[model samples]
Each structure stands twice: as structure tokens, then as C-alpha cells.
Target: MITDTHTHLYSAEFDEDRAAMIQRAKDAGVSRFFIPAIDSTYTNRMLTLEKENPNDVFLMMGLHPTSVKENYLEELAHVKEWIDKKSFCAIGEIGIDLYWDSTFIKQQQEAFRTQIKWAKEKKIPIVIHCRDAFNEVFEVLESEKENTLRGIFHCFTGTLAQAKQAISYNMKLGIGGVATFKNGKIDKFLNEIDLTHIVLETDAPYLAPKPFRGKRNESAYITNVIDKLVDIYQVSYQEIAAITTQNSKDVFGI
Candidate 1:
């Protein structure tokens, strides 16, 4: 079975056919779905999705970097409240995202560091959402470096050097639909990285693989990603699925 280590299944984009979408994923052998929080606004919906899917959906609680705005402290407080209330598989979709807006870069850094510390304290992994801020994200990670700090670098689209650096910080590279894109450079050197340090994700409702590129993504589409990885790693389909699924379990402890 394949595990989508990072996917926003709770997003409103799936409202019309959420159940059908999930069933399709299961049918495609993508059985595990790791849902990351964007902010407190979607907390109830995310929990509701997990409640409905129970065995299929797992939740991670954190304020997304792109959501770090004027009242980010309040958002972080909400994240802490949820963590204190119950269990979470990870502490992310948190990191730096300077691609969309740089106005809150400082706030994003603070939120990222704070969440990373919280993850370490809770002994749970983190799922980072980095976009055009590799140096910035690496800076915070370097400062907070420790044996306990660990997680996945979601939607990894960096060079080999950055991939190694992220792995050095105890993170697995979250390979997604981008790997199937002709311009997505990660595919060029993915073979150099071990499958042990890679995990599959779709980042659903976004970053669909080739042929489905620019279209709204769903969990079932992860097959396209798997196909791409099979070519990149020169491995059998079952081997890729088994190894990457184990990698996901390694990071999330689930």
C-alpha cells in the first residue's frame, strides 16, 4: 500500500466528492492519508475528516507558514491548545514560504522555530512546508538542530545539496507530483538519494503530476507519482510502494 505522507484532504476543494475521492485512493492502493493543518480555521473540518475516515486519515496540527499573518501568535496559541487537548501524528505543514509574500518572513521564522521546538518537546515528527525559502528554513533548522528534531520536508523541490542538508537534520524528502514534471529538477538526481530518505505525497488539491499537471489533485493520483519514482529509482512498483510506505511510517510513527 502507498501512504500519502502530506495531503490536504480536508480542504474545501474536496467537499463535493470527498468520500468518493478517498475511496478512489484506497482502490489505487493509496490507503494512508496524512492531513496537515493550515490554521485553526480548518481544525474542526480536519478532525471531522479523520473521524469519518478513522483508519485512513491521520492528522497533524500546526499553523502553516503561509497562514502566518498579523495575529500569528494567536494562531500558534490555537495550535498549542489542540496539542494539549489530544494526540497528533506530527507538528506541521510548518516552515517558511517567502514565495507568496515576504512581509511576514520574520513571523514565519518565529512560528517555524516555535513549532519545531514544540514537536521536539512532544517527541513527534514535523512536516515542513517550504517554498522559495530554503535558506531561511535551513537557518531556523540549523539554530534548533538536535537529535530529536525530525520530520518530512513537504513538497521538496530543492537541489541535491539541500536534499542532503534536510536529511542531515533528520528529515525525509517528501516527493510529490512535482517529480513528474519535465521541469521539476529533483527527478534528475532523485536516484542519488536513497529510497530510505524519501516518502510519497500528493499535496492534493495542488501540484498534480504530469498529464494531470495544473489540474486539481486527489489522493488516487499518487499512482502517477509512484510511476515516476519507479522510473527514477529503477525499482519495481511493489518495492517502491513498500519502501516509501515504510519511510512514511518511520517519520510519523504510524
Candidate 2:
């Protein structure tokens, strides 16, 4: 009954063996798959995947931070268009990214704030994608703090204080392959945080767990993440699975 609260199975990297990878994940007890949006370009592919695996795959809509550029207004409009027409699990993979380019920092912040409004209006959870911009993310989140602005901090790799700050906004921390890396420091900080605020993810076709590190990742690899959690928290696999799955359901209502 393992749940991969976040993944990107539709990426071109999985083109050849997508079905096989998903089947392997199911066989490994990775039953739930939450698909995130990269941008408008992948919308059709995302819908196609959801249509094929409606029972296991859930969809989210938003403009990813890196995708925020000069034409960000149009991207935000597209996100709103989808939310207004149909139901999505969340407003996700959205936030600030200064790692790649700082040229659009201001635009990224503006776009993130606009999407936050849509998430609040639709009463859906948010999935934040933070990289080299934790302070920027916290700034937006702090200003928009409210009951409806609840969600997960995808691929969290911040300090214990940052984790607590995110929790204060009624958000969950999305733990993934990074936690299993040999030099990964996420586990050190995560051990200090409450598991009640943790959710499992693969961020698939990327961030593969150790032993499988640097390899193409998929939901099936989440088993490795679960194994690490058992050791970190000194709890049974089933116990960690059950609690994390429940935590995911509490946030996504899936």
C-alpha cells in the first residue's frame, strides 16, 4: 500500500518502458501515483496518462517555476483555464527557482503568487518546487498564509527551521530519493521533524534512490525510499507505509 505522492511518469525519459515501469511499481506495492505539471507543453501528455490509469494516476495543474519567463501571464491563464473546467488534485510543481536563472526571479514570484490565489479559490492543495530559493518561497507563503493554502513542499531539502516554517502553513514535506543518498543531509534534518508532516514521492524519471542513484527513477524505486525510512525512524515498513499514505490522503483527499 505504498503511495508515490509525486511523480513524472510521462517524461520522455520513460517513453520506451513506461508501462513496464508502472507495472513494476504496482508489483512493488507502489499503488498510488500523483502526476505533476511541468508546463502547458505537457498538458496533453499528462491528460493521456491520467486517462489510461485513472485508478492509480491523479493529475495536478500549474506553471512550473522554471517555466516562468517573459510570457508568464499566459501560462498562469492556462493554469486557471484548466482549474475552472475540471477537478485536479492540486496546484503543483510551482514556486521559485533561482538555481537555473535569476533573470525571472521577480516574474517567478509574481506567477507563484497568482497561482496561489487560484489554488485558494479552488480550495485545492499546492505542491511547491523550491530550489535555491527557500527564502523567496517562504516569503510568498507567509504573505498568503491561510486555511486554503495547504499542500506539500516537493523534494524538501531545507533546514529543520524551514521544515517547521512550512508545517506552520499547514503543509507537508515531500520526501524522495534525496533522503536515500549517501551524502544526502535531508535524512538528518528529517529525523528531527515529525513523520506526520511527511509524504513519500519519487519525482520520477529523476532523483533515483541510492544503489539506483543517477539511474532513471520511477515509482517502483519508492520502495528504496521506504526501506530507508524504516531504518531512519526505526519503524516497521508497514507502519511507515500506512502512516505516510494516510498523511498523503489527508492532504490530497485521494
Give the per-residue lDDT digits (tens) of candidate 1, residues 66-182: 899999999999999999899999998899998999999989999999999899989999999999999999999999989887899999999999999999999999999999999
Cα-based lDDT for every prediction? 0.94, 0.92
TM-score of 1: 0.99
Please list the residue runs of candidate 2 whose C-alpha ends up more than 4 Å from where it truly belongs after superposition.
Answer: none
Per-residue CA lDDT of model 2 for 1-254, tens digit only, reads 89999999899998998999999999999889999998999999999999989899999999999999888889888988899999999999899999999999999999899989989998889999999999999999999999767899999988889889989999999999999987778788677887899999999988999879988998999989999999899989999899999999999988
Worst lDDT window (10 residues) for model 1?
141-150
Which ranges in model 1 have alpha carbons more than 4 Å from their true place? Answer: none
Residue 185 lDDT, candidate 2, scale 0-100: 85
Per-prediction TM-score to the true structure, in the order listed? 0.99, 0.98
